[model samples]
Target: MGLSPSKRVDAALRRAPAFAAACDDAFDRCLADAQGAFRGVRLYQLADAAARLHASLRASVPLVRRWVPSPPPRARVDAALRAAGLEGEAELSRAQLGEFAAELFREAVLAGAAGIVGVGVAARAAPAVVGRVVAVYAAGAAAALYLSLG
Candidate 1:
């Protein structure tokens, strides 16, 4: 048995502060690494993408509770990057951008799961609950990108 849905949400919320801190640290490190290895618009684009990923995960909790079905994961991520103006930007190749997007998304979702675990939420429910959280985060990220850059 596991915590109820609402209890899981509450546990996640309690865990969020720590999770958010970890996300910030990871994103900053990624940005710093990019600075040394990238420059100019490429660098800026990576940073922007990272920011969107971080912000999207941070904002996902509420939206997850209101879950709606969306396109498959690849499509969603692609749409989000495109909506965020990552396509044909010449700042980064499609492959590069795709790799970065996938990496960042994975990191975000893992962070969510870690947060749930950190808060001592029921282990059994973590995957399903975390998936819902991450799905909504992706949607919000896509929407934010579209509104801001589409």
Candidate 2:
């Protein structure tokens, strides 16, 4: 069987340092600037799907303007990630990252390329985004774990 959700989140937290650093460098102000578009788990999952791209400098989102596009639809994200073998994964190998990155960038470009970053800032902020999601996710998971144990 798969791990409990709490265990899974904790595991992700253990591997969260690098992504967290990226968040520190970019997401805080931008999250507010997104005007609630990037809040909570939506932001988290976007990063999860784009984990590979976020790590690379090519996808780094620089906060300059006040407006940001909305993230892509989520209905197909899980299925696509599963097909990519990335669903629920905390860490990814370089080869896997390349495959996922190309797919995500392609989709993001197709979805919205409003000159935000030559593709679209909305779906492209995973590197600048996931750390906050991890923090929020881990906090929620910890609460769930505590309540369950208590």
Candidate 3:
């Protein structure tokens, strides 16, 4: 059976560190490509770019039971673009689309990258701390056993 929605989120969170580098690269490329097409592009090109951005993020997540699960990447990208002053228009200028892509990439990298690093740090630290605690407890139990025997 597939993982529950919550479990899928947890899996994404847990594995984000591994996928983060590629995600960053993809977003960076998207930003750069958008910037290059800074003038005289068709409307479909802009929409295509947005769609591609969504697909890239969707593909980045390791276990893909759904096209997109919770924390919807496409919605987040659109929201980020809107926040950056992209109105919901049927047609947009090349510069506008570039700006939208740039904003989306910037927000995604900023939020997701920071989170991945924080999670990575915590995940690594937790095991070491747990190992030390386990070791100390084992040592104490062994000493107690020795005392009882004596």
Best-fitting candidate, measured by TM-score? 3
Off by over 4 Å in 1: 1-41, 53-91, 120-150
lDDT of each: 0.46, 0.41, 0.48
Q: Point out the worst 10-residue segment of candidate 1 by lDDT.
A: 63-72
Candidate 3: segments with Cα more than 4 A from true spot: 1-48, 51-72, 117-150
TM-score of 3: 0.35
Note the residue pairs that clash in candidate 1. none
lDDT of 3: 0.48
Top candidate by lDDT: 3
Models 1 onward score TM values of: 0.28, 0.28, 0.35
Report the Cα lDDT for residue 7, model 3: 39
Question: Taking the tens digit of each residue's C-alpha lDDT, what string does model 1 give over 59-80?
Answer: 5544222231221254444554
**Model 1 superposed RMSD (Cα):** 14.0
Instruction: Give the CA lDDT, 0 to 100, for residue 110 in model 1.
Output: 34
List model 2 lDDT by residue over 3-87, tens digit each.
Answer: 7543443344324444344444334333444565644223343454444334432333321011113333455444445656776
